[model samples]
Target chain A: MDRRKYLELFLNESREHLEGAGKQIEILISGGTGKNATLKEFYRNLHSLKGMCAAMEFRGLTELLHAMEELLEWGRAGNSSRLLKTVGTLETGLEEVGALLGLVENGDPDPSSRTGVLKNLRSRKKSRKIDHESRRPRNSGGPSEKPEVSFPSSIRVQMESLDRLLESTAEVVIHRLRLQRSLPPASGGPPGNHQENLRQSIDRLRAEVMEIRLVPFGSIAGRLRDAALDLAKRREKRIEMEILGTEISIDRSTLERLLDPLFHLIRNCVDHGIEPRQERLRAGKKSVGRLLLLVTRIGSELRVELRDDGRGIDPALLKDRAVEGGWLTPQAADRLGKEEILRLVTLPGVSTHREPDEVSGRGVGMDVVATRIRALGGTLDIDSWPGRGTAFRMQFPLTLAILDSLLVQGKSGTYVFPLHQIESIQEVPVGELERGRNRCLRWKGAPNVDLYSLDEILGVGENPHRKGTCPVLFLRTDGSRRGLLVGSILGRRDLVLRPLGSPLETMREFSGAAILDDGGIALLLNARTLLPETPGPH
Target chain B: MTKNVLIVDDTRFIRTMLRDLLQSSGRYRIAAEATNGREAVDQYKSVAPDLVLMDIVMPEMDGIQATVEILREDPSATIVMCSAMGQEALVVEAIHAGAKDFILKPFTEERILTVLRKVLIPQAASPKGSSN
Candidate 1:
């Protein structure tokens, strides 16, 4: 076999099968012997997985699966008691196989140390079979047969092809927009009817093509559940995980990128967020802690909120830790509000855990999660009540390809702000600007909105076209509202986002670049970065 | 005459290996390739290949079941069941389901060609002398 040519396919298929079986094992462990149908499905998955491993010549994984299949066959033959006892052993064997598969994926195919596991499985199977035969002399037969399941309807497609299709559709939309701009305006009536119709049709086509890149949250939910189960088991804690809005679909790339961060957060919740059984009892809470992951789509953004009902983070402690670590001075730490203090946990290397453990406290803390979310053009908010619970609400764009932006002309150039971040735009008189050390503007309704001129923030000197009245954009960052002053509002546009590569990416002021309708590029502003640090006591 | 062959396996690696091996021999042309047994049967009907190399354990339907289904439609359809070491029972069942011959996986190029020649050119070829 030309293993290099199909190694990715083999690894992907193996991972899928193993995940399916692992999920079934979790379900069987929790639900017990009543889930006979699940057991059968689990058997089939393991059997197919064994075949793939054999074809790959992964002897350890093959032997492990074969032993598991034999044990499952015994269980299916009405020896549920024996199977129940060996479920832990089977899970351990499955993990070993997973480890071996990981090694193979990493270019090491040595299966030399599997003899101990194989011997353990073979001896257990022999002893169990003999025990069953002796107990029931007449009724000792092999597993009863079950009917085969029908084929699944869906087939896997390469992600590269889906991306190519998305790119072509985006190109078509861009061209259509360019074509519309080139046409002359209508004299009187309701504009060009044919052009409007063509635009609508192209919009629908673009939507359909984008939908092809979406995958439901349920695809990764099983793995999350498995992780929760494993962590709860290892820690001797009882955790009930509730997943909501699993039917919501996210872009495939976003889903893949989010998995690791989600894993880290869930592990943190199980390890640190949830209190131990006795601790929970002392706190007048139930013995089984609850961890909830809720996903919802609001317009073009997907909000994933993971909440754990456990001992919440103490903001005061976070502040003290920040001061001790020199990340913030004692005076500055004291001035922070409760929410601002809680946000301090996301600072690098600032773990609240007093001692580092194997699971979460090796210095890679919530800061990494925040960084990952920011990289995906998203925001993360931490809300916790010291005695109640902690909730990390993450908001991400539905897809990274295109964004709805409000284009504004700045002194440097045209800039686009993500429409979701903008609260409102208003004309503030120049005299109302409170310029005592830090710029501030009192809009009629939002009195505390700190204002900064776009030119000053971009270090582009001053806007030559500044007039008596300033157009201030009210924006929301974290929980606070701020104002951004620009030259003029150029209206809203759906722009395809292109990443600024190389030296330009080092500039945190701009998120990315987008091409306008007139064929000029506008830099998209990162509102979070633009939000001035709570103007220190001046 | 160039022979048409259908390769069936759930794993793309195995199917690709078979296709490359057969194509490199210059004796066979891949008529179709299927990931599962149902697709194998459907492609067999459409392509009517001279031979089939089928993997026994697959989703939707196994090779044995597909062999039975294909043999029922055309009794003389030539199928070589692909088996791994632990699937002796399944290999036996596949043969009974009308598979012409069987080949073990992780097979060498020589072993595969020997099996193919035994089934496809039985009168003119001997297993030991059919290398080239």
Candidate 2:
């Protein structure tokens, strides 16, 4: 690979390292014990990051991680003397790395200088030496010495190489499926059996490869907590962070993509949702504000919520802002539900703050946050009361690897509905279908969302009635409940999802495509793509 | 040579930068640097420097215990405890244990030189009684 490619890989890996550091800092701040194993793992991670950064000749990142590694190792040795200061420096260093990454992304890479801070710290360290001796009474337990860290050679593979290998494996599997179908079923019996066996083995191998791609959600939660803590400190608000369901994991790439949006949400909580100490006191709330990050696994979905008990969003003010931003009319705002009103803050270019702070307000908006959440096959929901604070809930696909999809028959092909999004499927009789306005069904006493046949949405010109298949899969997208109409229901199974090529990406209905065991392309439905707009009364 | 001072800190960059700045002071020099408490104690015995700049909290043997050891070895030894914020208690403990003085971390030239002159000057005024 070219130097540019190497730089790209460095950027990606550096991001992961920063994220890990951010999370570890959160763990430390939350009063979680720096367990020996965790510390050793963190130390090794920093050491590896430093080594790779040095090899890549990204001196700034290398130097920063080297400093952080020293701090963490000291931490491992149970040094609390200047741990907080070191943590602060590490936070700033991570920010600098972010800035450098941005520069690299924009084709202007400057590693910048750490000389100023480094010099200051060095002087402090050296000056302490004279004092270290004078204070020692001379007879003590002596010095503690430990063996050096040694790494096994087997773990030396670069992340990009791992990624490339997975991608190539996916390609080969796809091609193999194509070849198996092309062979005559009876004529190629022996060879067909061999291909079938190869397919099963490849499927198993793909599952393992996917496991390597996962990064535990605990890390993402930790980083968000750190960002929240920093903001709380800056604003002089006393807030505590606690994370639940930390052991639940997500793919590394998805977790990385989540950092920015999570940071923005926490910023909103600190800058907007959280009030000053006096304000909070007068509101009959405790002086110390509480922000809770709750992560829970709900079946196939992972939900991360940021809940703050500060001053909440005012519905009236939200209405005013929505109207001012041209997102709502006066009459329309009156009839909006509380949930609906709460979502106005998430509108593109809309902010509730009368004066935005430098940290929270930038050119890009929460629309980007929503879009990012959507891109990961996730949905974001906001709930708030007038004085009870706000909570932003982001629900993501449990994993980005192989999805268990409910394959539904479309006229041209099978559309794979991510099983996570499917609430339930029912065979609604044709007579039971409410034909007054759109394709809704009156099922089990509740009026479920109207379902649209994939043929209708894809404009495939397949008449659902002509096909004589009536299976409706209820779906929850963007906080609204809806249903998708499909020709037939194919039972759930695991599929190795593959990204669509550039040419096919314009079709937004499906997020990606995956190969089936019997050799066929099943389109993975983008559940968020088909959210239903609130209907007007007839 | 240049009034050798042994530096003990966990940060390498900090150690190197300190070495550079103190060398520029024209009155003091860094004899050796150790990244943690254990190495710091070893380096101190070997260098037998004129002064010591000790970080209060370090791996293995902290500045308090380190200060206790050095003072026991040579009561005449001049040691200054270096502390960061939230280390007030530790600094007091280190002082009680026999540290001559202390300087907070991320110190500027003024702070560094002032603390050094206060702790390193052998003939300087005693901190008003209590000598071991």
Candidate 3:
């Protein structure tokens, strides 16, 4: 259906309904009927308007109506006494919505999302809660109401059906990809045109399904900001936390997974990255440190950069620490590039902090940041300029449900490798792989690196690959590359990965199963297991 | 024969939207329309449609009340409550009131047809599977 065709109808009916709601509120406020049904009507009027606005994608209007609906609920069951206090705020909210509707009618930019109407509504709710608290003793009525946490509550309407539809859509898309890859192009016929049209239609459907799965970044922005502010206050650090791209949306699961990683990153920024006011003045930087979380959508990926303008990491010190920590040899540390030196801080043993503090150093480690980001099919790059600032640039996939993976033929069978972790795939003669007397292998990229054999590590097959040139896949681990010798490099494809469950999950080698286009399942090799941590050959 | 559907809502826009959606599908026909719960129950008793499209909150009488009233008269009635955002609690109450199923609004054409057909077509085709 053309939703736009009903724009006029929707606006007209919404106006009439909202007008009726305004009067209904008056009757309730003035205690005209003093009946429950009057309040019910008033709530319904706003509720219906909210639904209409939501469907029309009028975000600001929907939020206002939603707030109004919740405020009206305060009067419903146990909280009827608070109605008189809320009526004034409700009137003001309605007036603001009226102005917002006029803007919609005039084709002006939506002011609803940017306005403070919802903020005022929330503040009022808080005050009322306080008022209620003082009047009634503590823990009196057995948990009456949940405090509104300055954010919209998520309601997954028809979550099951939506998920089923997405799965079913993936099946169709995979089928299409397989068909097109196998079949030759049809020349000059309606069949070709039909195929093209179907492709376009399917692509559009996939995009729409993915879009619905996305929630605005603003949904989690509140929590991140709150955490940053709370940490800064405790640390006695004067800092301004600015979050950009609050309106940008991402998959719900991605947002959930990212919350902790972001929290830790923000914690790091506030506690360690931002310098004290005195230190900042001495360094010729602003006293009030700036911690910025900037998010932008680049293609099908999201670039979330957490930057703090403070005392940056000195690469020389980090290099020295790496040597002292035995994570790297002094020579290896000296060979590291500018970017490579900054990365040593993310290593488990190396720490930029001379002393781990109460705020950030306990349960979660900095090493977990890179691992978590990588697990979500993302990459984390640490960049810092000494005495300037440090920025953690993390790029996360829009949807990890479908992963771009490399299909490699192992001795055991075909295995899937996450493309994000894999660096360059090289085909080199076996002669090129030379093990030194000290047991370190020398490759072209590094004078000495750790070499792992797929056949031996995975116990894939009875026979090992010998003789001729071998294809090697180099994976970026921490700041170094680990070379893996595989049987052969098969092709690459976008795969839908399902987590291994039950007895299969017990296996440490494979993280999940990536469903191939041919309806075959290939076990995804877990990089963490494939390359177990060991003291590096300096 | 197409199944008869009774559309109930206080808003004219919503009613018209449901009607258009149902008519366009060609498998269902609007038996009647009612603005509120009082009219909804009365219309159900008279027209006796194969299904009901009920809006949860209305002026005179609510959809939950109408659902209870209709189910009391004919326990075999097929009623699907039409819910909107923030009406989750009421939707649950309607379900307890014996609503067979529910469709959320603002309505998409596909969503409406899928929900109505899900409730109506199954009973029409296989009476034995209608155990619930």
lDDT of each: 0.76, 0.66, 0.75
Q: Please give each candidate's TM-score.
A: 0.53, 0.51, 0.48
lDDT of 3 by residue, A1-538 (tens): 7666667887899999889889987887787875577777778788778877765667778878887888667646436556765766677678778888888888853446334445545544442322221122123211123333233323334556667878998888788768876778867344564576567678778788888888999999889989998898898888888999999999887888899899999998888889888899998888898989999987667989999998788888889988988988999988788877887877886776787688798324677777667666566788997778899998866786766789998877889987876878887677666654323455665555676777767655421455677888888755666778888888877677776765665455766787777777798886645564553455
Clashes of 1: 0
Q: Residue-wise lDDT of candidate 2 within A402-435, one digit each (tens)?
A: 6767777878888788887877887766655554
Among these predicted structures, which one has the highest TM-score?
1
Report the alpha-carbon TM-score of model 1 versus the true structure: 0.53
Per-candidate interface DockQ score:
0.25, 0.01, 0.32
**Deviation from native of the Cα of residue A104 in model 2, angstroms:** 50
Better of 2 and 3 by lDDT: 3
lDDT of 1 by residue, A1-538 (tens): 4556666877888888889889988988786555877776677678767777766676667767787778667666756667664565567667767887888888976453232343344445552323221121123222221112221213356688788888887777788778878989745223464566467667767788778889999999999989998999999999999999999999999999899889999998899889999999999999999999999998778999999998899777778888888898999988788768888888887767788898887446688787777667777788997768999998878888877789999877899999988888888777656553454434454555667788877778653344488788888766777888888899887788877765665455776788888899998888877666574233
| Top candidate by lDDT | 1
* Fraction of true A-B contacts recovered by candidate 3: 0.50
Candidate 2 lDDT for residue B120: 52
- Weakest 10 consecutive residues, lDDT, candidate 3 chain B? B123-132
Best by DockQ: 3
Q: Which parts of model 2 have CA positions greater than 4 angstroms off? A: A1-149, A152-156, A185-192, A362-364, A406-414, A423-427, A436-439, A443-463, A466-469, A476-482, A487-524, A533-538, B1-132
| B1-132: candidate 3 lDDT, tens digit per residue | 678889998877778777887888887788999999999999999998888999987778989999999999988788999887777888889988888777776567777787676566556765533322
Docking class of 2: incorrect
Per-residue lDDT tens digits for candidate 1, residues B80-125, read: 9987767789888887787877887667788789878757764224
Candidate 1 is graded, for docking, as acceptable
